[model samples]
Target: MFSRIDRYRWSFQDSHLPEVTLFAGENVAFDQRAVRELRQMLEVQGTMNRWSSHAPEAFPEGAGLQKVVLTPDFHKAKGIPVGTVVQTRGFLLPQAVGNDVGCGMRLHTTSLTAEQVLGHQKALIPKLRRMFFEAGRNIPMNRLQREALLREGLLGLMDTTPRSLQEGLWQLFHDQDLTHEAEHTESLGSRRARNTLGLEDFLGQRDFTRDGQIGSLGGGNHFVEIQRVKNILHPGIAHAWGLRKDQVVVMVHSGSVSVGYTCASMIREHLSRLYPAGLVHPRNQLYPVPNAEVHEETVLQNWDALNAGCNFATANRLMLALMVRAVFQDLEMPTDFPLLYDATHNMIWEEDGTYIHRKGATPARGFEAMQNTPFRFTGEPVLVPGSMGTSSFVLAGLGLREALSSASHGAGRVLSRGQAMQGSTQDLDDLLRQHRVVTPVDFARTRPDVAREKLKELLQEAPDAYKNIQAIMETLQGAQIAQPVAELEPLITVKG
Candidate 1:
């Protein structure tokens, strides 16, 4: 099913798996292990190409699938491939969206320069330690406020937030209407999601704390970094985004916290029971909820629950960014950290009247498609963050139709977390010293041993665990899906 196409791309076709389109296949070196796993998944019943006559009338549109695109950052994940974009006509697949519902990136530009932060590293590092590790007490919000943000996202919380916090937000976004900030965020940062699982089931019996995961950084490749725009590739787009060379920015990579996981688990369990016993595949547990087979009430309930998870994730990222902003305010730095854009990679989106499941791919709608957005002239700002200690990119979408209006999320993982920890000769202290990144683990005042162990786990997320960022960038530009606007280098990195 897998064969060579060209120097840069590869094509995969099978009787079961959806047609695969991969970019930079030669450069990144496709892992056959992951491809075999994908094939096992496709062989399952009710998938894109494996539906049987005896199966429920799931795909009324006859498979209801268009294509599956793998971005340049394409690589192996556990059951599904990361950097995958699946387009379906009338069916929605839960596995395609993966576990993280609203996993995404948020960029904020500040008036402060990289030099200022670096110079004050000693004073700033300890402050950051307290802010992230001290139970996030610095972020001004009560249980009710957290619930409002989760239910209604940034817009709902903006109104309910304390006056001081609201003022701080306004100070950051002086020009743009604070109420309309959701327009800049993907999916408007909120959806009409309801609590389908009921309050007790969703919260779990032992977990009584409200918004316990709101401002958390979360583990596994999630981080908040202080970066400087090293260079501007497209001057006009950079200017439009209010980004300048050498300017300081905060880039957050996180997701929906525990809310998304719970939602996914609930949906999966519901569908698993309904799946035909004969059609179930051992290697693949992915269940597709076809629009035709599902009752209208069930559909609405599922969407509401999914939207709630997505909204929670979107709000969680914002809250984390706000926490960073609070730190900057305390440090007497530029508190005017206006949001440049917020985009999620792990999601299922309805675009151009079709459902697209982007596991680790960013939506790259073209200028014409986004004519109503503030960046219609330049297309959406697709923020592609690099692995830790590497150069992240801000790119303008070219909106290539064949590519499903999507691009890579990051340098896709070359090594899993477990693989990264084995046969490692790199020194953690030297690596951080070279990158000049500050973390709470670095300043463990009381538990130095525990901090050191935490630091070792972080080392597993090193740039070496992922594909080359330069190659991924070149592939996107070569494919004409997205063009780089600016490159950002990290200075301070905070990981959970």
Candidate 2:
């Protein structure tokens, strides 16, 4: 157990962001699309209001079953909105878990520092370019290797990119790290979901699932960031989390892999038809389905499948880290090698027999159990990677917040990626160059105005786009949400 921090009550208060209401109100006119979604959402929300009025006991003693603190980065998502959290009695909504099951962020440090990286940056770019192509030819494995993969990109299909060889890489990985207990913890590379019928059936419906989806990043908000540890608030906590001031680290933020897309795509269709006609209960209608078993089985399978993809993504970063590490190794870079401080932005959890849906939030636990292990939390360090091109943070769970001990997934999203590409790349270029961040992957990297415009759009995702980290930590201070240790800012970013 840890010492309680501070108390801050959270009751349903006035809306902070404009053009949004907590519940249906009579203040402003509604857009057709907004009205449609609201009308439908309220049908379930209204029922919840009545049920809570009648059965307040459904909510825990003190929790009162608050939905979620939708921060500025809030947006529409699979079932629950992106920032939503569901603490329930006996149900799990698959949509709240989203398609990319177990999508999260992982941060690790290599024995490389800013100056050392500066020396080898150009030489490393070509190798960095090669890493993308390396996934295809050299990696082995066919279907079996693909099942356990969690990174959404590697499992199903890919856009312009090549299929991911991560599954093969995962199998071969153990051949080298025989001494390390890498496989004992959560498997980084294995395959399961693609082999299942549920996933298969789901993928059949959406051609996109079967299309070139392997080894690609999730569309919308998921991204990867290279950040510098701006500061450390608690050095003891920071050391426990393997962090140091001025340390440069790679933050890979991704989720669920392709199988999740298959599962969610299929399940969503079933629910869309089931609602308004089937046994749409007051509480279960918005995200309706048969029993929790069927869908839970679907998502659970997705969990296994996505984890495989994520494992491969981890492998991708591990190799990438090795590349960075190797370069720094030559330069005698002054930094730490990366360990697992994974921030899973989208995933689901089984807590006390209830489905704690973390739409775009990190699943946090305590550090006592995870300390000195790969997971430096009570379970493992929950990575709360800030927005792309911004700060990323390391969080350890206290696991006391009964509303299902969780925290905001990240600096969420103020605008979509499409919106970001609209702005000037110039501003983004200046900012990136000024910050020493590099965007060599894609998306108008050389064009300044194009990148700047894009940056401005993503500015919607800037620090201002999120709940003030201090405020969020303080508000949930005593609630056992997550404890902060160190802060990481962007240095070199790869946006896929």
**Candidate 1 — worst ten consecutive residues by lDDT sum?**
199-208
- For 130-217, candidate 1 gives per-residue lDDT tens digits of 7777664333355555555556767666756545544333344333456556878976787765553533433333322434566777
Query: How well is each residue in 1-496 modelled by candidate 2, as lDDT tens digits?
Result: 0111223332333243112212111221112332233334434444434444554543333322334433222445433566556554433355666666656666666545655555666755444444433332133333433332332332231212233333333323332233232422233233334344444422333112222344344444555555677889778767765677876787666555565566556656655654443233654345522223424554454455444434444444344434444434444454455354444455555565555566666656665544555554335465666554556667667764544556666654443444545655556556655654433333434465565444655554443343444444443334456667777777665543
Clashing pairs in 1: 256-313
- In order, candidate lDDTs are 0.74, 0.47
RMSD of each: 3.3, 8.6
The runs of at least 3 residues in candidate 1 whose Cα sits more than 4 Å from the true structure, single-residue gaps closed, are: 15-17, 44-52, 55-58, 139-148, 159-177, 196-210, 277-282, 423-426, 443-452
Q: What lDDT does model 2 reach? A: 0.47
lDDT of 2 at 363: 59
Model 1 scores a C-alpha lDDT of 0.74
* TM-scores of the candidates in the order shown: 0.90, 0.67
Clashes of each: 1, 66
